[model samples]
Target: MKIGIIGSGMVGRAFSIRLAELGHDVLIGTRNPIITLGREEPDSKGIPAWKFWSLHNPEIKLATFQEVADFGDVIINATAGAISIEALSKIEKDSLKDKVILDLALPLSYSPERSPKLIYSNEDSLGEKIQRAFPESKVVKTLNTMSYKVMLYPSLLPRQHNAFISGDSEEAKLIIAKIMEGFGWESKDIIDLGGIITARTTEMYAPLLFQLSKIKGHYNINISVVSK
Candidate 1:
């Protein structure tokens, strides 16, 4: 499978490297590949993301966003939530037609008090917006509830944890679920929250996730749902 991932941030890089390692042909989409590859300063991880990926996972290729849209069979939107719309706008909606899109972006805003606020709350959600924007795309909201590390390697936590999926298309969700299972997530670990509207619930969890990280002293935690 050829996977096109938008954004070269940590999430995009992690997904790219892991999927490439899993034998998928991966293409990382960026506004400017040259600029991304030329970065000298390190990111939060203390090394340039492109440089690290090139050295460690050279199988993944870098290309313009348009090229990514053309190359991918399945596209993953891992861009920052705040600029997701702007980033995706560069690609023609027709180019994304009928493709399954795994949307992991969460719209978050920080206040002067330092508390995070949801840009799209109960009335709206980034997932729904994306679906509306690209009516032909099968948009599934997922992987927003956990960090990049925990997303691909849930077993690192030792305890069982859950990930949520919300989208209008059952087939699209199934495709994404298979990918998640390939990443070591059990079938039960994936919970389909029903339709893209429910993305509001998952997207709203961002603030709580940050609070939990502060309380737990690490970002390597996830929610485990138990029901009979």
Candidate 2:
């Protein structure tokens, strides 16, 4: 499958590399071509070269946002929550019309001292907004509840962790589930928590993740759903 990822941050880069490693053709969409080429270095304090190198591979190519949208069979949105709608608006909606998008973004706004806070209300969410904006596209909300490291490397955990996908389209969710499995997740580990409306709860997990990262001094933590 050809996958295009918007936002070249940790989540975008990590997902691109992992999917490519699983034999999927991956393309990353970045706001600036120079940054994608590593010509314009990212802030060293926020993202180190070694970490970037770990997520970037020779096989993954970078493209303009429009090109990525047109080229992908599935598009993954890994952008900052606050600007996600704006970033996507730059792309021609017709290009992504009817495409399956795996939305890993949360509806969070920037904060001076911490990761962004969820700015969306209980009645709406990033996923739902995307779906509404591009009614032709199918948006499946997944991978937002966990940290970037655990998004693809769940086995590194002490035990298996649960990943959730929420969307109205069953077929799209199934396709995303297969892709998730290829990234080293088991079918049993993925939970479909109903339609896109459920994204509110999933997005809320971002704050919990932020707090956990602070307490654990790590951003690699994950959650598991256990049976009684």
Candidate 3:
């Protein structure tokens, strides 16, 4: 299976390496592949993003957003929440038509006092906005409620935790659920919240997740859904 991931950041890289290792062809989508590949010294993480990819996951390729849009069988949007819509606008509408898109972004912004605020809330959501923008694309919202590591490897922690999938297409949700199962998530652990509109609940969890991480001093924690 060919997978195209938008955004070359850590989240994108994590998904790329993991999926590629699982035997799927992965292409990272970016605005400028050349600039990203030619980037200088590493950031605070100590390894340049491109170098990290070249060294650790050479199997995963990089390309422009358009190329990736045209290349993938299923597209994964790992772009930042703030610029997700803008990034999606770069891809050709026809390229995304009838394809399954796994949207893993949260629309978050900071207030003047540096407090986190949701860019979209209440009646509106980023997932709904994306669905509205690309009506032909089958969009499923998931994996935005936890760290990239946890998203890819749920078994890293001993206890069982919950993951979510939301979209109008049951087939799309089933496809994503299988991918999650491949990533070590139990079938029962994945909850289908039903419809794209439910994406608002998952995306809205970002602030609480961040706050819990800040308080706990780690990103290892996750949500554990207890059903009655």
Query: lDDT for each of the candidates?
Result: 0.89, 0.85, 0.88
TM-score of 2: 0.90
TM values, all candidates: 0.94, 0.90, 0.94
Lowest summed lDDT window (length 10), candidate 2: 42-51
Model 3 over residues 22-115: C-alpha lDDT tens digits? 8888999889988888887775556466965577666878899999999998999998888999999999999999999999988888675754
Kindly provide the TM-score of model 3 when superposed on the true structure, using C-alpha atoms.
0.94
Clashes of 2: 0
Model 3 clash tally?
A: 0
Model 2 CA lDDT for position 188: 93
For model 1, residues 1-228, the per-residue Cα lDDT tens digits are 889999888788889988988888899999998988887778765746677658867777889898999989899998889899999999998899999989998897766688677887989999999999999999999989888899999898988889999999999999999999989999987999999999999998998999999899999988988889
Candidate 3 wrong stretches, greater than 4 Å: 43-47, 111-115
Worst 10 residues of 3 by lDDT: 43-52
What are the runs in model 1 whose C-alpha is more than 4 Å off?
A: 43-49, 111-113
Model 1 quality (TM-score): 0.94
